[model samples]
Each structure stands twice: as structure tokens, then as C-alpha cells.
Target: MCSIWRTLQRGTLRDIALVCLAVGVIGLSYGAVAVAGGLPLWVPVLLGLLVAAASSEFLFVGVIAAGGSPIAAVLAGLLVNARHLPFGLALPDVLGHGRRRILGTHLMNDETVVFALAQPDLPRKRAAYWLCGLGILACWPVGALLGGLAGTVIEDTDALGLDAMFPAVILALVLPALRDGETRSAALAGSALALATAPFLPVGLPVLLGLSGLVLAVGRKRETEVIR
Candidate 1:
């Protein structure tokens, strides 16, 4: 406890807690939305445990709400979350090596990455991980509980602009890192490909496009080095 407290102190535990609070409030709305849309409370809770990405959870929830096939829902969810693979791969170096590294990498998700990157300075890698993991665990379960109870109370969250916050927050966390020509192009290309294929494909194409972009990025980097 003493060591953890020191870690949080160096990492500005107050700020991390505030961010987690904000996410918690937002998560309540998510729960309500999911419940209102027809998902059982357990679904979101279980999803929170496994699928750490909000985008993927939203995709899955949307598919189920729309009465889409289960397979389609699964595919769409995977597509939206495929970006995590690269994100996970890239984070280990920053986190260091070994068992803790594995835990941190596995727990790193959209919000956690954003929260960590947002902090210009931090005490230790574990500090960021605790802030993020504890934050998610705190917020999601509470939101799900509230959602179960008050799901019927809220009428139209879309009109209140709460619905837009999720995507905006996720994008805010990601877009800042794309401040380069190659990354920007890759994102655009991947998005375009995904949109183009969405009509004919069964909703898994965005993941495929993202994978393609990763491959392209590697090749492009190699080519640049070769040219140099």
C-alpha cells in the first residue's frame, strides 16, 4: 500500500481518479443505453471484463440491438477492436519487460492508452496501469448496475448528446498520435477501405483493412530506410 501510494502520488493520483470518475459517469450512460437497447445487464458486465475497448462493446451492442445475426455482431465487434493488436504491440517497449509488462499490455485499452498518453509525466508504468485498470473496474460495474435500475428512466440519450461522447472520446485518444503523414494516410486509407467494403462484406472488413494498413506501414518504413 505504501509503495502504491507513492506511485500514485508521483503519477498525480488525483488527476487519474478524476478521469476515472468522468469515465464512470459516462459509463453509466453506456449501461443505460445498452439496457434500453435490449442487452441484459450481464452482457455489458461480462463485456467489460473481456472486451476492454468501448468501440468494440458499442459495436456488439448495436448489432444486438438491431437484431443482427450473432455472427455478424461478433465480426463487427472484432473489426472495430482490431486496432488493439498494434496498440498492444507498441506499448510493451514503453512499459518494460516481464510479467508486469504482460499484464500491462493485456490491460491497455482505448481509454487507458489515452489516459496514459495524456499524462506528460508519470512515476512508473505500473502507476498508469493501476489508474487505468482500477478506473475501468470502478466505472463499468457501477454503470452497469445503474443501467439495470434506471434503464427505463432515460428516454432519449441521443438527443442529450451523450451518445456522441463515446466515439469522440475514443477518437480524441487515438487521433493525437496520428500527427504524421504516414500514419494519417494509413488511417484514412484503412477507413476508406472499411467503408467501401461495408456494403458487400459482412462487417469484418474494417479489421482486415486495419491489418492491411499495419502491413503497409511496415513495408513503407522499410522502404524509407532502404531509400535513405
Candidate 2:
């Protein structure tokens, strides 16, 4: 355990700071966009409470703005963020045992995961926990507040192209992780399915298809590894 903790602390604090900056910028941009999109002031504030993925937060806001029911909105948010479940399951081997570890496991998110996974030589658990914990406690909420405030003052959100930023950020963040053939194929297939269903189904279907795609990617990855 001592060795594990030491290993965790070895990550370059500088790198962690860089990851935090990325998250803060993207999160703040989202809050500003949400407000510019006509979301209530409380919307961005409350979103910070969830402390989940900013991408899912953007999707959740879209559903609410579209007049979707609250139940459907919640379902959509959960579906889009479902990938976190496995992320948590895979975390413990890195995090070790205790209350702080447990809490950190729950807070592990896309940005944190990216930062930690990319640092293959560092203590995986420690780097992951610190990076995510700091981001959750500071970066996201602060960004939201700033963006929300900025949104209130802007008269022409439409002209700013704020709406496109959410999808753009999501793509920029997630696309880099699709390095393998199976993961890329799954994303493409899921996106195709989502597009095909977009005209018929409303809010929730795209998320479901995305989840389906992720599951396929995971299963296919396991199968290929087994063959090797």
C-alpha cells in the first residue's frame, strides 16, 4: 500500500496541471454555451453539482432545452455516462484500498482517465485520483460559474457559435482515445446508427446507440486480445 501510494504520487505535477487547464477551459466554455443557448442561470450551477462528464452535461442541457420530459432527460444523461461504470470497476486494481480510494474511484472521469492512462509509467491509481479529484472540486464548477456569468452578459450567443463548441470539444476529447480498430469501428457504427435513428426517435435513442457501440467495442477488444 505504501509503495502504491508512492507510485501514485510520482506523476508530474506539471502534467496534472495541464490536464486541469484543459478541463477547466472546456467546462467553462460549456457553461457559457448553455447560458447563451437560453438555459436558466441555475442550469449551469446545478450541473456542477452532478460532477459527472461535461459532455453528458451538455447533452442533458440539450434535452431540457428541447422540451424533453425530466424522466427522459435523466435517462439520457445516465445512458451517455454509462461508460463510467466499467471505468470504476477497472480502477480499484490501480487505486488500492481505503475511503479516499473509494471516493476517488467514483470521481474518475474522461479527462482524468486520459491524463492517467497516457502516463503509462506513473503510479496509475495515484495520478488518476489526484488529477480527477482536483478537477472535480475546482476546474468544472469554477468554469461553469465563469461561463454562466459570461453567458448572461452576451446579447448575441447565436453569433458566437457557442452551441458548436460542446460537440466539438466532445469530439476532440474522445476521438483521440479511439486508437484501436475495434474502438474506431464501434464509434463509427454507433454514430451511423444514431444518424439513422435521429429522424425517428427523439432525445434518448442516440445515447442508447452510443452505449451499444461502446459495449461492442469492449467485447470486440477482449475477443481480439484472447485470440493473440
Per-model TM-score, in order, reads: 0.68, 0.63
Query: What is the TM-score of candidate 2?
Result: 0.63
Clash totals for all models, in order?
0, 0
Q: Best by TM-score, which number?
A: 1
Q: Report the Cα lDDT for candidate 2.
A: 0.66
For residue 68, model 2's alpha carbon misses the true position, in angstroms, by 1.2
Error of 2 at 225 (Å): 11
| lDDT at position 83, candidate 2 | 64
Model 1 agreement with the true structure over 97-193: per-residue lDDT tens digits:
7876765665676667666665545555456655677677667667656765687665665676876766676576667768878888777777777
